[model samples]
Structures are given as structure tokens and as C-alpha cells.
Target: MDPFHTYTALSHQELGDRLFQGELIIFSIADELAPFLNRTKQLINKHFGIPDPQKAHLALDEPTYAARASETMTAFERDPEIKSLFFSALETCGVNREENFYDRLVLRIVPCVTSYDKGRQASVKHHRDTWGSNIDSQINWWLPIFPLRKARSIALYPDYWNKKVANTTSDWSFSRYLAEKKATPSGEKIAYPSSPQALESIDEQACFTPELQPGEILTFASAHLHGSKFNLTDKFRFSVEIRTVNIHDVKHGKGAPNVDNAGNVPMYQWFKQIKDDKKLVL
Candidate 1:
């Protein structure tokens, strides 16, 4: 069977099962998803003060661009209405927003080769989300606020989906990673801190990088060995990333195989409860 498939009329649970089996599920833009993505685009525009967020890095220096990027990420996280749009969008893809929990939405500003990172960005290494979150049932939803045309923007090493590659999970911990990330000096590179990364070289020919439209959603198992290919494009890449888990699947061990992750972080409790929206640390 093809590893990548499109959404049709399956129930959310069925969708979860396919994703758990390491399938890349694609859902084209729908009604609720439009407003949700538009709201994110609006926030990006507001903070960066640019019509094309993909060029925002060119408008400011390293520090100023970082500040605006931080503000945009924080504002979207703090706004309750934006989150409502998120769940509403998920429902259109058949997720039972009432029954599942979600991690905070993240706005990724993947800078081009010419942009300066200064340790303010997420890792671009080949790794699995489960290496950091330690949650097998976690499914990631990836979308571009603008059309993505660059290669490897969100590349997946599908050959490594069920295959083992030497990684740093055995020596990593989320708490320590967070502490060190916070301690990184100004203008210093994070170098992935405590996040797990492939210690072995990966073959680029086996990678699959989907060039998704603005509102198209890409869902895949958090354990998939995915990472960004360097931004060779002249403009910055602005995109949205959301992570959610089915509690039932997590509890029943019904997700992706732990092919190689040996990390010690148990982040299941970090998700916001769907009912009361209260933070859980269990």
C-alpha cells in the first residue's frame, strides 16, 4: 500500500489507526480550516507588518526578526478564539475535538539559508516527535500559511519509518533539554540541545517532501523520522504545526512502533484537556 493517502469518509478513529500505522494522511482545505489558517496568517501579518510573511526575515535584523517571530507565536497561543478555530478546523477533518487533547499550536518560521537563527528556531535535524514527547499516539498536523515550493521544507525519511537508525535518544531528556535551551546565550546556536537526532547519515533520495498548498493539512505519526531540508529558497518559510493525541490510543499502546526512540520524557500530561482546557502535567 502507498504510505501516503488522502482523507475520504472514514471516522476519526479509523483515521487514527491509519496514521498510527505510519501513513501520511492528506486532507485538502475545507470550510473551517480556511478561517483557522486565515487567522494565523493575519497574526503573522500583524506582527511582521508584511503582506508576505515568507519575506519577513528580510525586513529586519536578526534580533528584531526574532522578536517579531516570538511575539507572533506567543499571541496566537494566548488567544482563546484562535484555538476555537483550531478545533473547529479539526472537526472538518473528522477529529473528535471533544474527546481528544492538543498541544499548543506552534508557528514555525523556517528561515532561508541567508537568514540568521541565533538559537531562536526549532531543530532542522532528522528526528521523531516521539523522541521528545514520548507519546506514541501523537499525530502532527502541518500546514503552510503560504504556498510551499522549496524542497525538503518538511521532508520525511519514509524508509526509516519502521527501520532503526542510530540516534541520541538514549542520552536525551526533555527537562534537561528545556533547561539548556533556556540557558543558550544570545546569538548562540541551540544545536538541538536535548532533542534526539540521527547520529547516522540519512539518504536524501528516500525522502518525501510534500509541497502543500496554504490550507492543505498533512497528518502523520509523530514517530515518523521527519525533518526540514535546508531552505534553499530566497524567502523565509512560515508554517503552522499542531500536535494532538487520542488518549484511548495512548493508553492502549495502539500507535506507531517505537523503532528506535529511547528518550526519557513522558509528556502525555502536557496536553491541554479538551473539556475544561486546563493544563495537565500527569
Candidate 2:
């Protein structure tokens, strides 16, 4: 079977099974998310006082960029219209949002700028989600807020699914990272202090599907070795990433293999309990 499957090709059960088995899936519901994406762009422009969303990339260098971005993301997530639209989009894509508890979805608005600064790289380095979070059963949903053309998208190294890579996971602790992240104020010189130094040594045999259209969602397990490809384009990359986990899988240890340390705390404070109609207090 192909490593990548489309939404129409799999049922909800199949998608769940495939994800646990370490496969990635891509599907499009761009039409459903168009309004929300537009609203997000508008919100960014309004918050930053930029006339053009494309030109908004220049504001990333501002001292208040992280705080401003976090505020904008909170507003976007709290907007009733956007929340409803996003939930509907998840349902349309075969995800039972109620059944699977999720962490706060993040709005990633990456500019074309790259920083050579150590410990505070603008672009992500090759790493697995397990390195930062304890949820071995976590599954990530990623979608582009705008169309991606040419070689501009995240790549997954499928060849390393079961292969080991030399990383800093042994010396890195998620709890320490989280504490440091929280203690540091927005716009400060915060860094992922223990980022793997051997990332460049990893082979480049990755699956880079750069033709992802707007509204297409990429779903993959947290254990997948993935990272951003160099954004050669001048346009900013707007995207959203939400992580979900099946309680059953986590309880039974049925998800992807975990080799990294568990987080000191779960990434979320509460989960939307789907089965009993009651909130799952974590």
C-alpha cells in the first residue's frame, strides 16, 4: 500500500488503524475551510495593521511578533464561526472530533525569513513529536491556509519509520523544555535548547509532496520523522496543526512506538469527552 492515502480512499476506522500503523494520509476539504482561512488572514492583517496579508510576513521581525501571533491565534480559535467551520471540516474528513481528544490547535504563520541564530531557528529542524510531548498515540492534522506551489511543504522521512537516528532525546526532557517555554516571555530570546545536532546527517530520502492545495489536510502519527523543507518562495506559509489522541490507544499502548521520554504533564488541561458527553479532566 502507498504511504499516502486520500480521504475518499479510507473510512474512519481505516484511517485510525493506518495512523496507528505509522502511515500518512492527505485529503482536501479546502472549500469548507476557505472562509475560516480568509478570516484568519483578515485577523492577522487587522492585528498587525498590515494592508496585505502577503506583505504581513515583514512584521514577523517585530519584537512583539510571538505575543501578537498568539493573540491572533486565540482570537481565531475562539471565534464561533471559525470553530464551527473547523469542527465541521474535521467531521467531513472522517475524524470524530468528539471521540478523539485534541490539544489546542496552533496557527503557524511562517514568514520567508530564515534566522541563522543558534537555538532559535525560524524553521523547524528534523525531529519527531515524541521528542517534545509524551503522547505516543498523538496524531497530527496539518493543512495549508493558502495554496502551496512547487517545493514548499513539510516533508516526512518514511524510510526512518523504524530506523533509529542519533538525537538528543536522551539529554532532553520535555518537562524542562515546557517549563522554560512558559517562563520565557513572548518575543524573548527563547530557544529549543536541546534540538538534535545530528539532523543534517539524516539521509534526504524524504517524501516531499509540494503540490498540496489549500484545504487539503495531511494526517500523520506523531512518531513520524518530519520537518519543513526550505521555503524557496517569497510568500509566507500559513498553516494550522492540531494534535489528537485516542484515549483507548494511549491506555492500551497501541499507537506508534515511543522511544523518547514522556512529558511531565499532558499537553492539554481538558479533553472533549466524546463517549459520555462529559469533559475529560486531565
What is each predicted model's overall lDDT from 0 to 1?
A: 0.77, 0.66
Which 10-residue window in model 1 sums to the lowest lDDT? Answer: 114-123
lDDT of 2 by residue, 2-78 (tens): 56777644555677689867888887677777777777667767776655554454545544555565677677767
lDDT of 1 by residue, 1-282 (tens): 356777633576788778877789888856657888778878888988867767766677777777787788889888887888877777778777556788778777778754464455644778898988888888898988777884626888788888998988887766777777788874457654546778999998888888887667889989999887678787778777888887777667688889888875678767976656766444
For model 1, the superposed segments whose C-alpha errors exceed 4 Å read: 1-3, 150-152, 185-188, 191-194, 279-282
TM-score (C-alpha, index-matched) for candidate 2: 0.81
Q: For model 2, what is the error of residue 257's alpha carbon versus the real structure, in angstroms, after optimal superposition? A: 2.8
Model 1 compared with the native: what TM-score? Answer: 0.91
Which candidate has the top score in lDDT? 1
Total clashes in model 1, counting residue pairs 3 or more apart in sequence or in different chains: 0
Q: Which residue pairs of candidate 1 clash?
A: none
